[model samples]
Target: MTEASKYGITLEKLRSRAAKGDLTQREIRAYFEPDERRGEAFAPAFKLTEFVDKQGKRPSARTVTELYFGAEMGVVSGPRARLRPRSRGRGITTTASAARMKVLAEGDSWFRLPNLSWPVSYPDDLVDVLRQTYEIPGVAMWGAEIGHMVTVQKNNYLVPLRSGLYRHFMFSGGGNDVLASVQTHVKRFGAAGTNPSSAESYLKASFDGALATVIGHYRTLAGHVRSVSNPKPTLYVHGYAHARPLPGGPYIGAKLEALGFDANSSLARKIVAAMVDRFNVKLKAFAAAENAAHPTYKVVYVNLRPAFTSAADWNTDEIHPSDAGAAKAAARMGDNIAANVPVA
Candidate 1:
């Protein structure tokens, strides 16, 4: 017979002897050790440690019960009630699925999950979708004591749970000074000569300058992560664009309408597309450099949808999301991380 088959018989005999107190825990541990490795190994000593440890050991009754009947003894005793069958739930939420797929596609599994610190304004539909689909666990960082401690100078103050652990990082500002400040980094290149559209050209030039500034900000953040001991992968989730025009300004779509353009104009689409594309390019460069420096650590970019609909959704006049909005965002973010990253 094979060694496994022979070992099965030995295990059966050991259990039989153990049931009658003929075999001590030490002996039980010793039998599992290889013949040449037995006695000298420390498993036997540790087995006895379990009996005296304050943490308490798995019940010895379990072993005795199994030895006598070859079945677990802790089966539920009460009458089992029939659970109502669930309807075929809606397919996983689009945002949740997309976020998960993005992480997996980037091929990084290590994640630093953070908790939401603020309330969001949207209906809880998205929150429910995230919870049901991802089965994410809440981490201790979500508590108010820890979540609000960080001061984000120009950015929204979301809880930074993984700051100590993450090597790669991304940050998203919710349509306020944070996004505006980041945008100021892009390099501005004006049109060659003045024309009727020279004013428009100058605006374009300014935006380019802002883009460069944002890139520098990202580089600085990445360096911070690398400075940590044994830094792991990190990615900052970022907002696409402001949902509103500016301080004391109309809503994004409304602004377009006021300018005699269709609220759903192609120009708006183009602007968003350009913003996304520029962000992706910068992200690729960041990822490439980080991967080269630390082959084991991977960098990634995560994009979140703009959630602003009114002034009430923001925490202050400047741009941070309300607590309710933050919670919804957190749930979406947690679900994404759980689906792609290993826990436990």
Candidate 2:
């Protein structure tokens, strides 16, 4: 038996990561250390919420809400969206196998946020399919306050961890984090004929750093799961599809200039769009690598950009999906989940 064996994960799992030079058994185990700082480590108390058991009994859980970006960014205070709970016969939504999955979410605002005026984001699409289509009791959700990745990490958001059973984790982020850093990249690279060195380096460094921190938290969550289940829970992540600027008046480039950047012409839009592609590429690579390294549970990447034809038609803004756009986007993701996820 290996170190991970004691936690319900296998030695082969750790070795696989070590084989790829990602992580070693000792490093993976270190992620689970209880004797550590708050933001620096993964262990934290579970939060209590309005959710109840299958029998309507509330579990004695000391639930926690990881508050970071939402608090400071005012992401939730904007405007309330029209929320309509799906019509349901009174009972817990269950999977076909009758297991309740706990889904924990965080990241940027593209995941059909609260007060966004849209009734449903694509993540909600997952709930609708599971409850109405699959007839599963709706799983409990820990909606990490909306914010950028760094904000989520700074607050130590309670990413889904290993428990007795498998839980579902969804990520609809990276857009905001990537967009925030766009100006730096745009000014540095947009001027050149092909590539901008300074901007590219900044974007590369920022993205890599952000990705590394997030995976550390991810590994920490998996490590938590490892202590409880053999085939741990799966994490679902998506790449924001390419978005183009609106045709009229204020293009994304001009907007960047307003915010103090080098985006003087249409090239800014192209530059930003290019960065979005780079972000998604790195995300896919990261997901594939983690999936290959760990057998406890895998990372599934949903490339959502291809689902849309024109970014202007689908996006309410350059960064967010419109109501009509979200409906279609949600449907595609729901279909993907139904086809790929084998909870039943």
Candidate 3:
């Protein structure tokens, strides 16, 4: 019987229990232990905690199963490493304390402080990012993509940008909406016949307008990430933008071309550059804030080859990435950030 079938209950049913707070720790353990004769590995139980922690809250059984499968597929890590007390008694150790001590225990192997709190999406991506870019030792060497949701302001209707060193602020297809909203607000208030001398107020209003949109989106994203119990500090964002255009249209278009489309166009290149410029600015701001807020957290930006460059990287549409493409992007991005972030 399949893993799902072996449980005698559907994965969704398990998730429903988790969502409804019906799945207790004992029940969760039993859910993973399919065989009655041989004891099931504790790894599943451990994974449940990791899933809950990484998601910032308890996850549905289905979500846990998907994460497990994804981890097995090298898509990401099933769970963040659990903090355990040293053989020597150092008083009672809570999970949170253990994690902090573990970083310290790992010593140079781990990056300390705010940097440690950065969200990790794909465990394999984390491994790749760390291995290829930064050389933090003692990391379990897993890769995964951070799961995030997008939000906009209720009044201003702004979406957060996704491309940045901080995964929280960068959003996919989210920046465009934010920029448009800001522009609209600027025009609307400008036409109100407010004196140009109120430039400071106007600017503040515009910034507030943008900030409201960003904050609202971030709050929603943060809440969702938290709901998953993801341990990393939630960094809200939208999507990625690029600096250059490939022979096709933009980098995304070039990626499509790589996927087998005739996307070569002048507009594609312009769009790519524009997107890149915007992304860079957003990244810089995010990095600066992170650096200020958490001195130890490292933030870095990487320029990767367009996905369209290789058929292996193309998703169904050629524009988006397949699982492999997402993996590669995670790795490259992680590596870049790791390398650039100053070690605390």
- Candidate topping lDDT: 2
- Candidate numbers sorted by TM-score from highest down: 2, 1, 3
lDDT of 1 at 40: 18
| Candidate 3: tens digits of C-alpha lDDT, residues 213-252 | 5545434543433333222323323234232223443324
Could you tell me every candidate's TM-score relative to the true structure? 0.37, 0.53, 0.33
Candidate 2 per-residue lDDT over residues 1-344, each given as its tens digit: 65334444333343343334343223333322222222211112222222111133332222111221121112211121111322322333223224433344444444433321122222233333333333222122223322333243532333324333335555565454555555434444434454333334334455657655544554554444334444455666676665655433132544466544555344555556667777677777777877678766667777777666764434534555555455556566556555556765
Per-candidate count of clashing residue pairs (backbone under 3 Å):
26, 15, 60
Q: Give each prediction's root-mean-square deviation over alpha carbons.
A: 21.4, 16.4, 15.5
lDDT of 1 by residue, 1-344 (tens): 74344333343454454444343323333333222322111111112212122233342432332332211000000011111101222444444433542211010001111111111122232223334443222121111111121223212221231333323233442222222332242222222222323323223455555556556655655554444444354554443423333333232333333433333434443343454445556655766777688765445544444444454554432223444544455455654465446555
Give all candidates' CA lDDT scores: 0.34, 0.43, 0.33
Those runs of model 2 whose alpha carbons end farther than 4 Å from true positions after fitting are 1-104, 115-166, 188-190, 194-231, 246-255, 258-266
Candidate 3 least-lDDT 10 residues: 103-112
C-alpha lDDT of residue 126 in model 3: 22
**What local lDDT score does residue 88 receive in model 2, on the 0 to 100 scale?**
26
